[model samples]
Target: MSNIVSVFAQKCADYDEKNVQSAIDSLFAQMGGVAAVVPQNAKVFVKVNLVREMSPEKCGTTHPEVAVAVCKRLLTVTPNVTVGDSCAGMYNKGMLASVYAKCGMTAIEDRTAARLNQNFETGVADVNGKVLGKCEFTSAFLDADVVVNVTKLKTHSFTGYSGAVKNLFGLIPGMVKVEMHSRFPDLTAFCDLLCDVCEFARPKTVLNVIDAVWGMEGDGPTNGKPKFIGHLLASADPYALDAVAVSLFGDPRSMPVLQAAMKRGLLQDDLANIRFDFERWKAKRIDNFDAPPIDHTDFFGNQLAWINRLAKKHMVKRVHPDKTCRGCGKCAMHCPAKAITLVKRKAKVDQRKCIHCYCCQELCPFDAVRFRTSLLYKLARRFSGKRSKNT
Candidate 1:
């Protein structure tokens, strides 16, 4: 395979409304220029990561300035550019329209007259004979001559981190994401499935732009601490883009998603092959940021045969919301196990049926689901921690 991954980074000290546009424009120019990838007059679909309904200050979704800059650039090539993402559980186009309005992209629809194609359909993706059934997708995605994947860099509770690859997962539509999660319950398996989804939609994603100007750390994608990285990254390879993102945090190899991607041969693990324009950008470490701990042996340990016999398999439980949830039904809609139900406008979990796949927590629009560890599990972890220190 050709060494197809190219990354260009640009440092912009401010994310304020005044400088955001110029920064994006400069980013576009430095990253091989968008014109080279997107042809003039081609039907281009720009997929922005709008995972949840939160203001730009919350850093829960892609910055509208980033999207506006992309649209502005692409419009130079084609007026056929369309921008949209299937929001989690809610399909209120007006809410998304409002986000665009706040970010100065209202002109995409109103002024520049860019097409807003929102109707998506269910499709199937086959991964190494394992078929992911009933995936909801926008027809514009499949029909587009080129796709620009714009994503935010953030840490995730389940998949380790969310970047260019995880952003596309939103395209699968609301509840269908839950079903996929149920099918591939393990993190490694789920990431493999994500790669398959990318392969199937490879033709669509011709370019990737990651908004790292401001990102989330420590249990994010949403509901995490925001860190200002003051950088913009662009690449043609999603894997390469994600690989670079993991390095920015500290240890890329330690990340489960990157480790899984490396094992599957989906990306180059060698950082040597990957080039970085450090002159334009610099790495900033996140202080006091601890990646959520996982039971390596339980999740990836080979002693499963022994543990299964000794400890009863803990059935997955729906993380209880410490506070009253907004009753958005996003969890119910995206529960892959279908274990969550709405009771009097509140979400109720049937622990017996929950597989602990964590789709509910990841897809919760309200960030209400907090992982609850039982007393016994806590004791076990305590013992495990002591044993590791002694060794």
Candidate 2:
């Protein structure tokens, strides 16, 4: 219930057999005792950021060691601790098994009383929001007595940034998430959909944790370079935790999802409103953090269709299926807009239909999807950069 977003300095390497058991103790202690937050013998679901099936060292998913540490602590308070996530792709036992094994989440089950979630059932739930009325939700999470949001800090291509709130997006069943993207193509609306999902799940989410020991920098939630931030953050308020996380690399308000959160009064625009050691956390900020190069404007939010098209054609980034594509249909299969197709055994994108959601880039397994910035947009950015420097 505290607005305090606790920032703790801890390294990924520090999560070893010698210290892994108590790795995140200080983080929880700073907010309040870990025991005080979790209910006794409750069905606790530790929903983690398993965006796709990838190795943990890639920094695309939550680190197994960090998940294990949290699971160990939670098991002390609850016998029904489950660590899992509905990763991108199909929602089935086989997909879950593959993702858990590849992401090293299976280690959590091997080491502690916490068991991997085997349930893949999903059902409709009343979202009852401005954009989302009702949507599919993973029953494993919806039925939980308490939910612990364990997310990775990263720069997202579509959302601008990914943190605790965006992490909850995994609760929506796997491939059905692509449909949500199609349903809300506008970034503002998609972000609103995100807010709706979080607001619906907020009552059960007691703790929000971010694994910042190694965070993805560019074109992320998938492909990106791992940057060592050497910190772990936690708060009962997912919005406040995200605000602090976004400040590590850029202005929190600049993120479309965070902007939407503010619009709904779920978060405040001012960072000072949140409780924390401001001086200490500020000193830890990564001044040169590399964010995705795409324009973050919500052109789709514009009412005039022609104006939206014109702006999108000149200012937005374009997705290209490069030579490394291997003629794979992965991008086409997951593209929310269905803008991609197989041509001459290679993937090609229809710019007219493309929604710029970056689902193609995020879900492509071959790492073949690439982005190109518009010439006019580049020139405009150069001019803006010069003006800012002169001022």
RMSD of each: 4.1, 3.1
Q: Give the winner by lDDT.
A: 2
Global lDDT of model 2: 0.81
lDDT of 1 by residue, 236-342 (tens): 87877887776675566666666666766666666544666533333355444545544232422565556632332552223775466777787877677778888
lDDT of 2 by residue, 18-93 (tens): 4544558777676567788898898999999998888988898888988988888888787899988988778899
Candidate 2 Cα outliers beyond 4 Å, as residue runs:
1-14, 17-20, 298-309, 382-391
Off by over 4 Å in 1: 1-4, 90-107, 110-113, 121-136, 277-283, 294-300, 303-305, 308-312, 315-318, 326-330, 342-345, 362-366, 374-391
Worst 10 residues of 1 by lDDT: 382-391
In candidate 1, which residue pairs get closer than 3 Å at backbone N, Cα or C atoms, i.e. clash? 178-336
Q: RMSD (Cα, Å) of candidate 1?
A: 4.1
Instruction: Give each model's clash number.
Output: 1, 0
lDDT of 1 at 370: 75
